[model samples]
Target chain A: MAESTEVKLLGLWPSTYALRARIALNIKQVNYAFLEENLGAKSELLLKSNPVHMKVPVLLHGDKPICESLIIVQYIDDVWTSGPSMPPSHPYDRAIARFWAAYIDEKWGPTTKAIDAVIVAGEGEEAKKAAVDKVYDILVLLEEAFKKCSKGKAFFGGDRMGYLDMAFGSCLGWLRFREKLHDIKLLDPAKTPQLVKWAERFCEHPAVVGVMPETEQLATIEYGKGLIAKVRGANPSKW
Target chain B: MAESTEVKLLGLWPSTYALRARIALNIKQVNYAFLEENLGAKSELLLKSNPVHMKVPVLLHGDKPICESLIIVQYIDDVWTSGPSMPPSHPYDRAIARFWAAYIDEKWGPTTKAIDAVIVAGEGEEAKKAAVDKVYDILVLLEEAFKKCSKGKAFFGGDRMGYLDMAFGSCLGWLRFREKLHDIKLLDPAKTPQLVKWAERFCEHPAVVGVMPETEQLATIEYGKGLIAKVRGANPSKW
Candidate 1:
């Protein structure tokens, strides 16, 4: 470990992005100091470190802050360098994985925004329907991604966990809980069977299983629910 | 040249993303075949190559297809194997560059979709107002990114023509057209003087200047105006 330096994770406990970083750290078997931040009352350290977004899963190497989970995961894979790698070999395969990873992050905003607006605040039908449609569209895209990326695999990287899986896998954790609490399953193993199957597989992995929130952890998601409700209420059309 | 392979670019000449890949190739001095696709009726080659997105700027290396402009630029940088790298030395700085890239991509959708829907179609007060707000917000974010990533640099990745600049520069080109068509001035040199200054510097680079569509090429974008209007009308609320 001659080249290794101290790696630290700056994150909130419940952030899906943060969870992705945690899972990557676990998979890479890299040691890190975890600093949890209250997203409401942002820490000076977090703000100074990631001033642009002023948010986390900021992975710090020495004093440098790597904001954005996907970038941080890539950093971990590249710098500390490890496990199965964030991207698979074969440039085409890697490109496919990157596409899905970005797609998930993009579509997640509106999809979940609509869900929370409906469940908590009960927003406009037009806005809600539009949001849900975006969600389903992304799911369809996800199904296609899984088909292409998962080539006889136990994971997205094929045979082992990769950075794309870590980014996507952690994000899905809240969906089932959201469905159960709201009485609507997004990935009905019946409809999006491939996506559901992928989730199931990810949940079983050694690194993922331990890092993921238990169903119980989601039961009292008061702050998260409130934030989503507020976000939707503030910008229904935007959602 | 043990790892050398044939390169080909499948892109629409007018597309903002396509310009990104073209600039990369021009700078790297990588020779490749260029196939301009009919976006309305996508070619079998483009569709087969990038089946998932089915979008343009699909750069195929040998047989491996790389979709998404930023991803394609990265693949080009990677496969070229040796060059003045697009991303700079520090991982944190690279993450900052990436965060800004993703932010612009995320924000551009809502802003451009809203504007293109109403402004181009020549329709609706409410939509127009909303579109204004969206674009304004993106400019603010760009302002901040320019402020944060600025290190007395010619581009977003600091000294070189990096991924973030390549990612945003496409829109910067379009922004000029948008201003001319809609009478909306974004990235105002006076307001976001830093970003506008950077764009000026980027445009001066001989490599960047060579590949980008000339003033005449952009003047003939009446077809693009129609296509964007159609897509925006179909999904007005998608933004």
Candidate 2:
């Protein structure tokens, strides 16, 4: 029946958002066709499927398209019920999971983008340090969340991987790659041991290993050059 | 029995985000004690409850504080089974409701903030016109969403007041007030008939009237003066 129902994912290869949905599907053990999008030349299917955002990754399940990577992950968990639940069963726990997921999407993304600007822009040394400090403050906030909520478990979702873990997992590769590129570790082992450990366990997990791109693959010199150029073009003042 | 459960709402009177939660609780017919917050002198409860955003409206249900307006709205709906479901029952429909809610929170808020900057910032006449045009474009996208998903219903969730309706409803009073303040009708009758109609229906909604602040109240000269000062203070460059 699962095979009979068509499940397809429209995504760009390098997108952290797309990787999030892939990780969820991996956990759910659902068979899905993956269509890589050429972001520069968006396909007709991609445009039609997600006209609002016109961006990947879009999940097409039985012909109905669900946009937004986190939403898609939730949808996969809801529809394919055979696997362990992605969000916890209890209502309050579910709300907590959703809350953190939102924080990751809303807060973490912008903070990282600000960090990216500082990294890519050819700025003064002091300015760069100040910018990096601002990002560290944001990281500290997440570290606090992990400490308060994780309940001393191996993952944010406890012993098994759940939505919060996947939410952060989606960004792990990009975070690690950027850290290496900048030669500064944002998720410092000494400062944020729990998150570092969580990242290590997540990357090595069988469910994630099959889908996540290698840190080296994402941290290429070519990628850094392209990112710097794009960031420079977007915010010329900083550069 | 409801009163005994210790239901409370921490909110600011001028805040549309806070108003969203009040409207939801009003819709659910839940009896909640309203604790008006002094944002400048944030109460210990407000700080303790929502340290992340430290903003209202925070819903205290049986001593558990749920932060974020939309999240609080959803929590009220989920917890209060006696009232009608705020979101649709079907999983896909629920996702659709959430998608639009996300749009309102993410896209609509920023667009309006940009519009606010042009209006209050003493920007050049041409710049103000261009900013208004951008807002109109954003409104058109929402109008398209209404056209596609609402299925010829009065509300986004169909016959009843659902999450999306309230999400927009919370902002409707402010939208109208701001339009009047700037002397530009964003929900122009000719262009956005549906949203205009939705706004009218929403205000008159019995479920909302008790909770929604009067348009005149929000449009007061004093209110406008305070807003101008606040906006100017936040974005000094624009002013």
Candidate 3:
């Protein structure tokens, strides 16, 4: 109870990264006040807390702020040792979890951003379809990873949701949103049956329910639309 | 002793990432076989060890292979608990160490690469000078980080060469090479006096003494030149 005091989370509702911090906090059952930051006019606390990246989900535990979603998640798991461990117990398992989390950020994250860029820019169908295909290809790799990591368990954390689960699961809302907007099935059952099934259980978890922003609601938000529009107008090569 | 058995490192001598694994092993006093890989014709061992990135600096502990330099370093530290801890002990300190290490990779790493592109491409004085300036600017930020992390101590790890030191120190050879090749003082003592001193001590440390490739020798290597040449020829936007 002493550790939970003064816990605050600086986040944007539509950010998958922010969702990660929220999910981790919820999983740990730590009481925290969520401080939503406006990307357009960021609060001083947000900017000061994360001066390096100036990006959100900054978890403020007392006066100290931990930035970077995955890092924050790890910090939560480290300090809140009372809860079900978010990171795997073994060193090698932890390494593998770190590897895939990095892959998701470096590879899958960019592909999704590229898809957003293409769709928002109203690019030709070929370009949009190609972007979607790339996502599926990456998902196939993730599916294999899930198989290896889960070892026939229900979650990536085996009996319960853990680090890798939170890492990938945060993107479920975006995947759902993209699927509806583009009229495409991203988590194709055939290609990623394991992930598709895992995703369902993930979203339905008590820790996750009502946490993710609704896909329909997300699509209507100017924040989401404006963010995508900004990416669309950015240098295409960046995507 | 059991964990040390069958330990092997797949690496390229010139690579800073590979250098990290070497330094960690040296510090931990772990006996390991160094298997040099030809980047032009990568060994099947490395190809299979890191199928995802197909990159150098894979640490094989028995049959399991650990990829990613930082992850490998952490894994080495985690397994060899007998040695001086590489990562900071306190959870918050560990988070700070990780944050700065990541900054080194994502930000400082790219700036250095861009400088290599400009210098290798034989770009004009203005372009090269701008690249060098960018590097110095990053150094200034790192200098600030050094001050805060070291707390007036000798190294980023305080009393000993630890994670952040290893992360940034691995690049010393490249920094030295670039300085000599470009006839520029990249780590200006005036701007980063603490880092300049820290760099000297880091290089001279018993664990680090011969692990880093000599700048003069690195400069003469075809491997180094060819790698920079490839970068020079790549799309400028990538730099």
lDDT of 3 at A134: 92
Error of 1 at B131 (Å): 9.0
Reference-based lDDT, each prediction? 0.74, 0.78, 0.86
Could you say which candidate leads in TM-score?
3
Residue pairs clashing, model 1: A86-A163
Question: How well does model 1 score by local distance difference test?
Answer: 0.74
Q: What digit string (tens of lDDT, one per residue) describes model 2 on residues B1-239?
A: 34468899999776888888888888878887899998679999999998888888888888778888887887777777675688876668777877888888877777776777776677767887898888788778778767766779988877788888877778877777667555578988788889888888988988777667765677454655676565556653442
Q: What level of docking quality does candidate 1 show?
A: medium
Score residue A211 of candidate 3 by CA lDDT.
86
Off by over 4 Å in 3: A1-4, A119-123, A226-239, B1-4, B119-123, B226-239
- Residue A18 local lDDT, model 3: 94
DockQ of 1: 0.50
User: How accurate locally is residue B207 in candidate 2, as Cα lDDT from 0 to 100?
Assistant: 74
True contacts kept of each: 0.69, 0.41, 0.78
* i-RMS of candidate 1: 1.6
lDDT of 2 by residue, A116-226 (tens): 676566665677678777778767777776775677887777778888888888887778766755557898878878888888899998888867876666645456557
- The sequence of per-residue lDDT tens digits that candidate 3 reaches over residues A1-239 is 33746899999888899999999999888899999888889999998999888999999999988999999999999889885678788888889988998888888778977887887777878998999899998999999999988889998888889999999999999888777656689999988999999999999998899888888678567955665446545552332
